[model samples]
Each structure stands twice: as structure tokens, then as C-alpha cells.
Target: MAKIKVVLIEDSVVALEILQRLINSSEEVEVVGTALDGASGLQVIEQNQPDVICTDLQMPGMDGLEFTKEVMKRFPRPVLVVSNAVQPSDVDNIYNLMQAGALDFFPKPTSGISTDYERLKSALVTKIKVLASKRVS
Candidate 1:
């Protein structure tokens, strides 16, 4: 089976590495490109044309909501939001992200202590595969 190509957009270097490792652990997923900010994220997405995009909701420039809107407007691909923010407002942001055309959202493990990597990995892989199967229209 062809692996699901994924582009990761995150501002934190550490979180980005963690996410990459988790996603690559799945046999069905591949990390084709990565970026620390939304502008570069758009560039990489355009260049790679990956099957899905996983992005952080909070970033230095052009947050995930804005990125999702632009990607939906220009590229129109499946977007899965992965963010560290878990507060009420952050949770509410997921709705906005969806409104801007995100396919789903995954909250990062709080406190930076991930004891359930396997479960998270499984869920992310499953979401990626499912989203990749859906047509934008």
C-alpha cells in the first residue's frame, strides 16, 4: 500500500520532532515535509502536495486557522489540526479551524509528558488515513 504523505506545520522544534516521530511510527504514514511557520508551511504544501496536512493551531506567524483558510482557498486539501493548547478557548478554536476547512483536530498531551504515545500514534494514523480517503468536494 502507498504510504499517506503528510506535511507537518509546527512552530516548536521539539514538538515538531515529537510529532514526526509519532507519525512515522505508523506503517501507513510518511512525513514528506515540515515547516515551523504558516508561510513556509504553505510553500511546502504547494511543493509536496501531500495527502494530508497536520498543523499546530498556535504559531508565531499566521496561525493554524489562517493557514487552513488559505490552504482551503488555494490548495483545498485535508487538514488535521494538532495543537498543544487545551484550554477552553483553545478547544473553541478547533471549531473556528473547522469553519476554515480543517478536517479534524488533535490535542497534544498536556504537561509535555506523553505516556500514551502508542494510543496517540494510532489515533493520528487513523485520522490521516481517513482524511486522505475523503475528496475535498
Candidate 2:
């Protein structure tokens, strides 16, 4: 079986590291590459051609929604927007990202793999695996 390649984009170093580890532990998914901002993430996707994208909504240069719109125009891969910040004011941003072709969103874990680590890992693995099917040619 082929592994699902996932390109993760996040600004927080801690969140980025944790998410990398979490996703890498899954047998179905592999962390192909990572980026600190949306622009870099988009470039990485264009270069690497990953199977899925898990990005933070708030990032420098482009941000997640802007990146999603640009990505949809060209790549059109499955994008899962996972963020640590979840405020009511972000509803429109989230909605726009989805409308722009994002696949789904999940509230990032508040703690560093402490608050229900296994559950989060399982959900991520399951969700990304399903999304991978849609990305493959």
C-alpha cells in the first residue's frame, strides 16, 4: 500500500512539531514536508504534490484562506484547516476557507498531546486517510 503524503502548514513551532509527530505515527499518512507560512506551504504543495494539506488558518504572507483559494485554482487537493485559535469571530474565515474548497476543520489540541491524544490521533488518521482517496489520480 502506498502512504498518504501530507504537507502541514503552521506558524507555531510547538504546534508544528507536535502535529508532525502525530501525523507521522500513522501508518497510512506520511509527513512529506512542512512550512511556516501559507505562501511557503503553497509553494511546497506545488513542488511536492502532496495528497493532503493540514494548515493553520492564521499564518504570515498568505494565510490559510488565501492559500486555499490559490491552491484550489491550480492544485485542488484535499485541505483540512486545523487551528489552535477558535474564536467566534473566525466563523466567516472558516466558512470562506471551506467555500474556497477546504475539506474540513478541526480545533487543534489545546495541550501538547495530553488532552485525549489517542482520540485526536485516531481522528486525524481516519480523516486524512479518507481525504487521501480523493486526492489520488
Candidate 3:
């Protein structure tokens, strides 16, 4: 099976490393590019033209909501919001992100690393695969 190309936009260094490791462990997916902030992420997305984008909602600049909007307006690719900002109050923000064109969401593990690491990996991998399939179609 050809691997799904993924671009990850995350501000936290540790989180980015962890996510890259976890996602790359899946033979069906590959982390093709990464950016520490949404602005840089946007440039990366444009340059790489990834199959899907996995991004965080909170950052120093551009934030995921605005980035998603711009991405949809320009690139129009499948986007998955992977962030720690999915609290109750953030529900509206999540809705806005979806409205801006994000296709899915993944809650950032509160404990830094997930206790059920395999489950998280499986879920993320599954979502990426599903989105990749949709993109292909």
C-alpha cells in the first residue's frame, strides 16, 4: 500500500516529536513535513501538497482556525485538527474549525503521552487512512 503523506502543524516541540514518532510507526502513513506554527505550517502545506494535514488549534501565530480557513480557500485539502484545546468551552471553536473546513479532530493527550498509547496511535492512523482514502476518491 502506498503511504499516506501527512503534514503536521504543532507548536510544541515535544508534542511534535511524539506525534511524528507515533504516526510514522504506521506503515500506511508518513509524516512528510512539520511546522512549529500555523504560518510556517501553511507554507509547508503549500510546498509539500500533503495528502492530509494534522494540526494543532492553538499556537503563537495564525492559529488553526484561521489557518484552516485559509487552507480551504487556497489548497482545499483534508484537514484534521489535533490539539489540546478541545475543552468544553472550546466546543464552539471546534465548530468554527469544522466550518472552516477541517474534516476531523483528535484530542491531545492530557498526560503528555497517552496511557493507552496503542489506542491513540490506532485512532490517529485510522483517521489519516480514512481521510487519505477520501482524498484519493
Location of the lowest summed lDDT over 10 successive residues in candidate 1: 105-114
Ranking by lDDT: 1, 3, 2
Global CA lDDT of candidate 3, please? 0.87
- Tens digits of per-residue lDDT, candidate 2, 1-137, equal 99999999999888888888889988889999899998888788988899999999888789888888888888888988888553456787777876888888777765556777889899988888888878522
Alpha-carbon local distance difference test for all models:
0.87, 0.84, 0.87
Winner on lDDT between 2 and 3 is 3
Could you tell me which 10 consecutive residues in candidate 3 have the lowest summed lDDT? 107-116
Per-residue alpha-carbon lDDT of candidate 1 for residues 1-137, written as tens digits (9 for 90 to 100): 99999999999888888889999988899999999999999999999999999999889879988999999998998999888663457757867887889988787654454788788888888989999998884
lDDT of 1: 0.87
TM-score of each: 0.91, 0.90, 0.91
